[model samples]
Target: MRWPRHVASLLLTAVLLVGPPILLVRLVGWPSIDSPQVALWQWVRDPLTEQNLILLLVGLAWLLWAFVAYFVTAATATRVWAGVRWLRRLPLPTPWQATATGMAGAAALTIATPTAPTPDASHPGTTTTTGTDHDIVEQADTADGVALSGGWLPYEVAEQVTAAAGLVWLRRRRAYRPTRPHRHSQDAQDLAPLPSTVAAIQAATGSRPPPPVSAPAAGLPPIGFPPTGVGLTGPGALDAARGLLITALLATLRQNTVELVITRRAVDILLGPAAPHLRPGAGLRIVDTAAHATALPADARPSLSHGAEGGRRVLILDEPPRSSLANSGATMVVLTAWPHATTWYVEAGGHTRTSDTANAGPRVCVLDTVATTDLLTVTGHLQPPAPDTPTQPQPQPQVRVPRPTAPHHDTIRPDKRVLVRVLGEPALLVDGAALTVRRTAARQALVFLAVHPDGVDSHLMAEALWPGLPGQRLTGRLYTTLSELRTAARTAGLPIIDRTGDRYRLHPDHVDVDLWYFHRAVDRAAAILADPSTAWQAVVDAYAGDLAAGHAWAWLDPHRESTRRHVLYAYAALAAAAPDPRQALAYLQDGIRVDPYNADLHHRAASILTSLGEHIAAADLTDRYTRRLATAGLTAEGALIRGGT
Candidate 1:
């Protein structure tokens, strides 16, 4: 297939070399040499007579012909041999030579046949072209019609055909060959019971605990390295730590053989089983240990309290008969680990077979006992309020109080709702009233409540408002701010506070918060979709506006955009629910207007247009959508959307 032109070139060279030699030898009528000696052969010569001159010329011609024949034969043989070698393995020519050869061939071809039919006319169905330099049309004349033929193939047509066929075949093959299903089987012999050769069996006729349930043995090797990039320590270590805990559970469930590579401190803690005790007046006391082993020393037993004054609860771990208490168990969990060196955990237990293997250390950090315990203790008992006694009623003084023109009350009840507005650059109307709290601290306090929208306690409020002040001052400042915010809320009618000891939180529903509406809209939308036929109208109603529009909250952008997209989808869904084709098309158009680039919108529009008897519009939209996706560099995926056309 390669060097096809070489066949023609070598043939031409052979013809040129061989033509004269054969003609000369025949014309000269040269006598064949019979002499065996080289000297005699060389001495033999042609007679130089005038008549012989003509014969000499003819002889010369024959000689030349013979030489040409020899050259042509040699060239032909060499070409054939070269081609055979090339067929076995080709050596690509240097780039320059390749380019030059292509140029020469193209030039030669151009000179021989200067132009091809750019405008195909031969076979109209088979000949289609895009960019062309010339045009041609073939026609057959008849009374009824003109039949066209001799159309030229576009340059890229062959390539496109081959690629398309390959792609089609690939897809067909994939469809024909579905994914393999999983199969698992175990032989009876492979499920033989474990050998007890080296185990320390007890001599006494004691009932052995039930053999642990058979488990699927771990099929991984052990290494002193990390697991899946999960470190044993850091900010996200809790998940890994949980995995380690789960590993302990798995060990118990799988009845895996385990080994401990714990630190000395952990060994010390495990050596003694500690129990918590409750005392009469002193509350709870934690005691060191209790010994349940029958083989325990008498002196040790007497000193160790079985039951003391405090409420006693004891934990006992009994060693297996003839088995070291430390190692024999269903779950062999390791507690301690060295800070520097890595340790491994292995599981070996199964119904069909047995093997020993270890995986790299858990991608989790060992718990720091001291630090963890201290943190837990410190966060446990934060007192919210101090005990106070009720004051006696004082009703002796009946001073005349000037009533407001609108008849104001002296005190606002705690349970009543009061509006509290925010005063700012844009001026927010919170709880359906204008904000009166002008101080930054007061505004900030209200902002914190609005930001939390759930509830915030007194401690956090104090932290937010008077973070730099001392504890008592901060507490005092928080009380003043709370009083001001409460008064403002009372004037505006909003639920200002719901107290629990000293903590307070906002009542989200009691006030008209923007977030409340947004969430309500989202929930309403979900409810509508839950039953589309009955709730479609409600879903459309809930999309009031962009979330917190004109508000400077960058964090809400993704949520806002997500809501916008859902709104568009809601429109599409409504389009589907329309009672008539006209209404459906209208809704589909509205959806496209909202989300022009959304493929689903375009698809829905196209489908609606098609149903409404608008073929051109439907086809145009479909084509536009396909082109849009193709321009975005998703041609393969676009082809799929085009139904593999």
Candidate 2:
């Protein structure tokens, strides 16, 4: 398939060259040749005949036709080959392309975006997103970072979260497809991955990870060099530079893969307010120096010789470096082309010419300031508190709660119950039958409601669902999720959700939550009631696990951690109440397993062991707890010598 055009061109040329000669031969056989020993005198005797003249004309015509055929075929083949090569060289779009662009990003390009469809009130069916939805939005198993959501997260934001999800997928890849840095000497006019391999894999696997669409003019490879100098200049220099910066930061989705070293002023110019939240953090360092406006960080002595090869520290600047960063072992990317050696000379329409090849590179990715700012908000960047945030009160039960049309609208009630479980892996069961929530947003909405029992106001819900995303941009998605949830409630004969004005809350009468049970038990244990130990036991029994234990919903951290502490408290209370030393030790051990870094649980267990004449066991528990806490970035109260010894 790759050379079909080549093959066809070859055939056409062959016919053109042979066709005329064959016709000439058929009409009058091939001309006979003789020695030209007496050529001038011999020509006079043979040339004047009618037969000789016809033969001369035919032979002359064949020679002219063959000459024309050769040049025509050569020209056509050269152009076709160039087109084919360029197509094969095209790269796949970066993962966060659409998400980063955002609704505001539409201004970056002139092409009109299709009108967003109105939210339909029909089926809660499986919706398709251009393969970006394939990312799993749970937290890392180590329980380190927040679980990121998909759907409406800004591209820059998605780049990090989605990249994290992609990282997990990559680690699970059956084969390693190493991405080599494109060398300056070569155009990287590389062929696409073989169709045979992809087709075979596609046939064998189901679409949990969607298949990559291979097109020749799809995307441009991110400009990543190994701690070296590159320049971007042309009409699109600024926009192209923005794209590179975004990509470099996104590479951190692999965690410590790339470190972007930038000056505070450069950050202010490039990112503005977003500069603070995304900086002074992992994989990005903001340097403070009064040396020069374009100087590297004062303390940044990056290793180029013997350091992390896969992990790169890319230092981007407004002007070319006076000192070679390569000697110091870090990448230096400049905003101007022809800074000495022309690396990339891009045009206004995005056509780029690179030093690597004479051919023009594909349309390189670009980002305007607005798009860059928008994406930076979500990606490795944190959200600063909004200036004009509304202080809307939580939805109160006394207010009028309007339900969507149900089995009987007048008789609408939580008369039938649906059990929503979020204490562990979230699940919904209506009338004892499991109801599968298909859309990720809808399920997340359900979990969001379960956590905020008092209900979330419209703006809060929108911002929480897709942080920093404009409500107008997410109107369809929000509507779709809420509409489907409403439809599900109606179908199940339960008033699961109640909305008044712009506030949405789960119906207290109809929907039962396991978290409610956990909270109640916790409240009872904390109360001044008699036999609080029994209440503590109830608390421990009620907590199946942390809230939405597996998924890394970014918003779930506080609630999850808070709930976990209550469980630890409950366990400690139960252990204290136990009459037997062995029973108390058992309680402590169970609590330790639940929260390994809980110093109190470990100490209590250790104390019990020591009193029972097991000093070695106490020491071992202390050592283990110390290490666990240190690993999780916590300070262990009793384990001081852990660092040195």
Candidate 3:
């Protein structure tokens, strides 16, 4: 709703709250209240004698306003609250319920990457740490990266997801380089993510800042857990403990900073059935007792690997019996909250209270065991069975860009033609070379025109391209940018941008855009009678990358994702219409290259390979899917299956 409407609603609410009492007071002060029937009857017989016609109309109008106000506030509040996450923090789900919820999150929620390399987070090393070694309690924002507790707000979640997803893409560029100690010290700014990734996050969630969801449960930052000892008890306590352990493991997985001291039984009982697949990645130690899991300086502990950093170890406990502390002063984690021993009490809902309910703190992101599994799976800790795989030991599918017979945007003739390419990096091709416009805004204006084929008014163009600028400045900026674009086109010896009256547009006769061609191909493919292979191939070939990739313009995200959907449709249709199983697998494999986390493509490819009697190859395809996820730290949202899924 607009501000004007909100203002009107506010006024209506005020009148609604105050109006009834005033009306009652006015009735009580009626002149004929103390008189007999004759006086009251006389006034009633000629109501105009007591009050003017205008006053009667005014009173009627007030009644109508009150009626309208009641519906307005009630409807808007309900609509607004429906999207808010605060009230949605669902009471912890049961094992069955949690499994369903957690699996759904695995499919929907994107797993975020940490800010920097931890011991085993990215490249395998030892216990986790982001920067300098600081005690968990000492750092206020320890959970800001992994947010084992989900984001407190919707946008916070978006920021975390987008940032991490961006990093995932960026790391691909550096994947070929060997992991060395010095790589950690390289500048972080060189690898910062673009804004388009943030918009992609919005596209994925259907909201740039999707509504905050009430998480099933969460615990405080594992680092910040009370060192003396803390316990989880009451309803959903075990689930909370499971989530807590998962959070701690994930957080410290980078640096080998945390050691788990528990018995064989505790693993299954605490972490659900997903616990068995846990591979002890670098720095993780699961021992039976504290004495064995004790933390010592690398210098003091000769058993430590040569040159390994020391003294930041954290002990995680879940009542593993059979040993004593023996003067071990390291941080202790106890499963059950206690009065004298447990020190801190945590409920399933993530409300933290000391044993006697005296000390309390705000809740953190929490999850049920099912969700915990889903999260760990996304981070590559737990491996779920391949939903549609025949078996998982076959040849790896090559990640290749399929070459098409039809011309792509890259090879098109630029002889006296202006080509705007928004499918990859925003570029203007003149004579087959890029035209570097003087101003960033100038480049943006060209892209803006490319996306909007029909001419736009200066006001719309100004507001979209430079939203918060004052009218005078917006107008000047728009005029300057347009002039610069025109000059660049002219210098390149082509007439490109055209201005008609108060509107601006690209010249239809001289200009062509890849986006325009993509839409045309998609439209042709949509025709019911069309033999679509040629059109489908055109659609696949046309998509070079995301719309205005590397740029973060808020308006570009929907277009990028929309284009992705179109390409996926083309891939599916093309593969379906292929003559043989091998051809279909090839088509599906190409699609997988573009989007490695697409479950449909992987499933389809696996099924095809299986049908062709290449069971090992099919198994390899499924195995590749899991490894790809582990490489980029993504979990494909596969087909929903619940048979010990």
Better of 2 and 3 by lDDT: 2
Clash pairs for candidate 2: 99-155, 100-155, 139-552, 147-552, 157-378, 157-379, 304-329
| Span of ten consecutive residues with least summed lDDT in model 1 | 197-206
Off by over 4 Å in 2: 1-223, 233-260, 271-308, 311-313, 323-328, 343-416, 436-440, 466-470, 473-480, 486-494, 529-531, 575-585, 596-645
Query: Which residue segments of model 1 deviate by more than 4 Å?
Result: 1-490, 493-505, 514-531, 589-597, 613-645
Query: lDDT-based ranking, best first?
Result: 2, 3, 1
Comparing candidate 1 with candidate 2, which one achieves the higher lDDT? 2
* Candidate 3 global lDDT: 0.54
- Tens digits of per-residue lDDT, candidate 2, 1-645, equal 869998997888788887887887887877665655654455678877786577568768977997887789798799999999999998856758766767446665766655863221111111223233522322211111111211111122223434333222222221111121111111211111111111111211211332222222322223333235667777776765665676666665444456676766666666555555444565566665322423544335343224655555677666666654433445666776534544777665445677566766544445555556544533435444444534211111121111221122212134446878888888887877777777777777888888777777867776566543335766666777888777766657767888988898888768777776666555545654577787778878888887887765544444555566667777777788799999999987888776665555666688788888888777787777666644533345434322212
Candidate 1 residue 82 Cα shift, in angstroms, is: 99
Q: For candidate 2, what is the lDDT?
A: 0.55
For each candidate, give its TM-score against the true structure: 0.26, 0.52, 0.40
Ranking by TM-score: 2, 3, 1
lDDT (0 to 1) per candidate: 0.36, 0.55, 0.54
Top TM-score hit:
2
Error at 179, model 1, angstroms: 28
1-645: candidate 3 lDDT, tens digit per residue: 599998997887777777764764576432223456765576678867645354455556567766876787798898889867666875766899989988988976776767874432211112223333210111123322222222211223334444444434433322212111121122222233223223333333322222222222233223445444455565545654565555455544333444434434456666655566555543345665544555344334332335434323445566532334422444455555444455455555555566665756434334555445544532335544454544322212222111122233433445536788888888887767787776767777887787666777998787656432346657877787898888887756667877799987787667778777776666555654557688778878878887787776544533454456567767877888899878888887887776666666667778777777787877777777667766664444435111111
